[model samples]
Target: MTILQVGALPVRKSRGGFEILLISSRETGRWVIPKGWPSKRLSDPDAAAREAKQEAGVTGKISRVPVGSYRYRKKTVEHIRVLTVTCYVLWVKKERKRWREQDQRTRVWFSQEDAVKKVREPGLKILIASLEVRPKS
Candidate 1:
C-alpha cells in the first residue's frame, strides 16, 4: 500500500527572486522539504503547514490546493514502502528562532536553482524547478 504524505515548499520573496527553504532529513541528513504523514484532524494544507513549522521553523500563508505531487520509496526493516507526497506552497511570513525539530535537523534557504540541485529526489526537483510564484495583487 502506498502511504500519503503532505509537504510544504516554504518560499519567501527576496531581492533576487524567490528563495526556497529546505531541511536536512534526520536519518540521512539529505536536503528535503518539510513533509510528514497527514494528520486525521487537519486539512492537507494545514498539515503541510504544521510540518513546515515543526521541521523548518517557519509559518506563513499556505495554498489551499496542492501545486503537485511526487512519489518516493522508503526502505524499512520489513519492506520498502512507497509514499506519495503532495506539495503546497507556503509564502513564509515569519521565522522562529526555536522550533520542535531544530535539534534534529538543519534548515536553510537556497536559490531556486540551487535548491533544485541540493535535493536528490527527481520528482521533487521537478516540482521546485517548475514552481511559478505569482506576484501579490
Candidate 2:
C-alpha cells in the first residue's frame, strides 16, 4: 500500500508578495514542503498541523480541503508503486524557537514563483498553484 503523508503549505507575505516556506531534507537535501506521515485517529487537518509543528516548529490553522497529491517510489517498493502524499494549506499563527534552532532542516522562504519552481514534484507544483493562499496579517 502507498503511504499517505500530509503537509502544510505555510505562506507568509514578503515585500514583493505572498511566499511559501520550504525546507531541505537533511538526509537527501531535497527541497520539500513541511510534512509527515498521518497517524491513525488524527483528522486530516490535525495531521497537517502536527507535521508543521514537528517538522517546522510552527503552529497554525490548516485548510479544510487537501491541496493536491504526489507519488514517488520508495526503496522497499520494488514492484509496488508507493509513496503518495497530500498537500494541505497551513496558515501560520505561532512560530516556535525550535525552527530557528534546527540544524537538520535548511529552511527558507520563497516568493510564489520561486517556491513553485523549487518544488520537486509536478503534483506539488499543482498544489502550490491551487494554493488558496491568503494574505498574511
Candidate 3:
C-alpha cells in the first residue's frame, strides 16, 4: 500500500523573480521540500503548512488546491515503502529565525530553475518548473 504525505512548496517573490525554498533531509541531507504524513485534525493543505513551519521555518498562505503529486520510495527499518506526496504552493509570509527542525535541516532559497536542479525527484522538479508565479499586487 502506498502511504500518503503532504508537502509545501514554499515560495516568495524576489526582486528578480520568485524563489523556491528547499530543506535538507534529516537523514541524507538531500534537498527536499517540507513534507510529512497527514494529520488527523488538519486538512491536507493545513498539514502541509505545518510541515513547512516545522521543517523550513516558514509560514505562509497555502493554496486550497494541490499543485501536484509525486511518488517516492522511503527507506524504513523493515523495508522500502512507496509514498505519494500531495504538494501545495505556499506564498511565504514570514520566516522564523528558529524552528522545530532548525538543527536537523538547512533551508535555502533558489530560483525556479535552480530549485528544479537541486531536487532529486523527477516529478518534484517538474512541479517546480511548471509552477506559475503571479506578481504580488
Backbone clashes, candidate 3: 0
Flag regions of model 3 displaced more than 4 Å.
Answer: none
lDDT string, candidate 2, 10-108, tens digits: 876567767788888656877787777787889877898787777777877788888777876545435655678887778777878776426788778
**TM-score for all predictions?**
0.96, 0.83, 0.96
What digit string (tens of lDDT, one per residue) describes model 3 on residues 64-125?
99989998888999999989999999999999999999999999999999999999988898
lDDT of 1 by residue, 11-83 (tens): 9987777899999999899999999989989999999999999999999999998999998888888988889
Worst 10 residues of 3 by lDDT: 128-137
How big is the positional error of residue 131 in model 1, measured in Å on the Cα after superposition? 0.5
Q: What is the lDDT of residue 51 in candidate 1?
A: 98
Write down the lDDT of every candidate, Cα atoms only. Answer: 0.94, 0.76, 0.93
Superposition TM-score, candidate 2 onto the true structure: 0.83
Model 3: per-residue Cα lDDT at residue 68 = 93
Model 2 ranges off by over 4 Å: 76-81, 99-101
